[model samples]
Target: MTETFHEFVVQRSPALSRTAYLLTGDHQLAEDLVQTALARTYRHWRRIRDGDPEAYVRRVMYHQQVSWWRRRRLAERLEAEPTERAGGDHTDTTALRLTLTAALRHLTPRQRAVIVLRYYEDRTEAQVADLLGCSLGTVKRHAHDALRRLRAVAPDLLDATAERSTR
Candidate 1:
């Protein structure tokens, strides 16, 4: 609620939004995640203002996402696409985007979190473990399984050697 907090929100909201989208794989859910995280951050502004508030917000978002995953039954039917393109990453082709999205859909919440935190956020395995509050071995296991599933679902995503010049 302070001026600095407002500035922090303005500065970090875009990156937070992108990460939220990657985490939820749904635009509306991502927006809600970011909003909830920011609200939590605001509540703890006095305590975390001197520290890395963004990290705190991200941690909150991740925890909230897990709880949401728990509440929602995984048996829900799959839709062709969750939402229109988030329009955040223009470099990736639509085919690759859709394939990756579908591939991600095949993963559990933890596996998806590992993949997103490690690759999209460029977090180290140890960091991912810490973020998810799991052992390093668990993080590695989730990552391995997630990649295996990604490979089975969308092999092209794993084969980086191929040239994808969609020009």
Candidate 2:
């Protein structure tokens, strides 16, 4: 059973790592977060192996993210700014993706987690709340707040780029 669980975790690590990356913007942090979550999941493999083990792992990741956030609020900005691209050459979609990712960086970690779970992972509010060990109301609030922040940061980039014709 332990071997099977280990195999399952190894198989799912890449996809989970990608999801973690989308949640956290840093590659190394995402890797560490996923690894930590996997280790925690392994600790409870006997009880959780029957049901959705991946769900259990994800729940660990969500709680760990929230705990990390509580220890260090996301209000502080990073010292290193993202490098600006030469605007004349980059495609609008690429630019929009970068803009959206950057805007996400401004969100509180809980808000960012809600946005990632609700949008990127396509999980419902109830699922997010369950994973985060919070109420549905909290999940809704976080998602609403995150969306509002994102909209405020890049209104034109998010709303008006369908027919962007940059020359």
Candidate 3:
């Protein structure tokens, strides 16, 4: 059973890491979040394996993100940097990606989580709510708020800019 759990986790780690990165836009933090979630999942693998273990782990990640955001005094630092760029070439599309991620950081942690799960992971609102342990209404509200915020930050203006930059 333990070996099965280990294999599952190893197979799923990349997917979870990508989801976490989309949620937080911080690679190191995403790695940490996924690791923490995986640790908790490992502890309860026997119980959760029969259920949707991925959803269980995702819930742990969401809760962990919310708790970390609250404890880190994020609300007070609305203008703080998202996270340092992980060293790369200076392209215009890179600039847009940074802008997009910066806009995403302004959302509440839960809203960010919702967007990541919904858009990035292609999950429905009910699924997101289930994973986050929230009411469906709350997930809808968060997703709406996140979309509104993203629109306010960049809107559709940057898509053209990004496409031009890529060429």
Candidate 4:
């Protein structure tokens, strides 16, 4: 049986949101990514319903994000220190996530996408290349550059990972 577009969204939105968050690193951008992907997918719903619709949506998201990155050359931001939340549970995991998010911000959009796809999504290099519509060499280069930037920005986080791996 084929799934309706609305049903597919209800079932897949959470997973899509998580991936979008990892790809964009900001909640608003993640929501926009999901929204944009779904809009694009809906345009060909009948044709894609019986096929791999989720994959199609994801590909749209990746393309949209990369396009956003290209347009970002015209955007500017004013940085401000994040206000601390009072009386919240602050844990090592929370700290690590914050540091990782910060480190991810240092990478280019393609590099960030490569890191999220390769590590967070647990995709193989070839699969990531296919999804990003880039060559294997491009994926490898992005992954390499992303990791080097991460290590430079968050050495403690990388060292902690290494320590855990060796244990």
Candidate 5:
């Protein structure tokens, strides 16, 4: 049996939330992104019920995010506040994640979206291009530029060891 919209949301929210979080890099913004996508999806649920509603919602989110970024000409910048640590449990992985987040912030929304789709979401270049409504060459350019920017911003994240080996 096909699932209801509410049931679909309940079952898929966590995965959607994670994707939104990766796209926006803020918990609150991620929640808002997911909510906005879901609301749009809800409005057209009847027509899209037999189709891939999840893909439709994700496409809306990607387009919405890109449109907002274009209008704003910048992503939202949130200052990190100091927090009390319960113990000395911080590790290298935590530091790496922080660095990666900061690097992602430096990328343009389109570049970041390409990176997320191509690498994080494990989508092919053609798939990303199709989803973003761009040509495959555009996807390749974005991926190249994003990687270049990321390498400049966080050399450690993009296979520094491989570079060293080649050199």
Candidate 6:
């Protein structure tokens, strides 16, 4: 039996939010992206009920984010106040995540999206190209450029082992 839109959202939102967060690199923007995507999905739910609604919503979010990025070429505003968190012992992981996030911010929106989809989402180049409505060559170029930029911006985060082996 097919699930209701609300049920589908409840089941899928957390994962979607994580993807959105990775794409936007800001909690608030991620929330907005998910919300906007869900809203659009809700509108088309009846028609898409029998199909892959989640994929539809994700595509909407991607396109919407890219549109927003194109329209606003201004620098992304960082959070003014850091939220308090329950202390954890994962300092190394936290530091690495922060470093990666900073490096991603240096990339263009399309490049960042390519990295997030290709690496974070673990999608193949063809899958990413399909999702982003771009060609395979475009995806490859973006991935190459994004990695090069990441290497320049945060060499430490790319591959410590490879760097060590070269040295």
Task: Assess every candidate by TM-score.
Answer: 0.85, 0.82, 0.80, 0.88, 0.84, 0.85
How many clashing pairs does model 5 include?
A: 0
* Model 4, C-alpha of 27: deviation from truth (Å): 0.7
Candidate 6 lDDT over residue span 1-167, tens digit each: 23588799899999999988888888899999999999888888889989998889988988888999889943486543334467854565675677777778788788988898888889999998999999999999999999998899888886753544677
Q: Which 10 successive residues of model 4 have the least lDDT summed? A: 74-83
Best candidate according to TM-score = 4
Query: Residue pairs in steric clash, candidate 3?
Result: none
Q: What digit string (tens of lDDT, one per residue) describes model 5 on residues 16-122?
A: 88888778877787898899999989889999978988888888888878887888844589444323357744775565666677788778778888998988889
lDDT of 5 at 159: 66
Model 4 stretches with alpha carbons more than 4 Å out: 1-3, 73-83, 163-167
Backbone clash pairs for candidate 5 read none
Whole-model Cα lDDT per candidate?
0.83, 0.80, 0.82, 0.83, 0.81, 0.84
Tens-digit lDDT track of model 4 for 55-163: 8998898888889989884242223332356896588667667667777777777998899889988999999999999999999999998998888878888876676
Q: What is the lDDT of residue 155 in candidate 6?
A: 82
lDDT of model 1 at residue 95?
Answer: 62
Better of 3 and 6 by lDDT: 6
lDDT of 3 by residue, 1-167 (tens): 88889888889889999888767777888898899999998888889998989888888999999999889843423444445546775686666667777778788899999988897789998988888889999999999988888888666535756577788
Error of 6 at 147 (Å): 0.5
Per-candidate count of clashing residue pairs (backbone under 3 Å):
0, 0, 0, 0, 0, 0
* Model 6, TM vs. native: 0.85
Tally clashes: model 4.
0
Question: Looking at model 6, which ten-residue stretch has the lowest summed lDDT?
Answer: 74-83
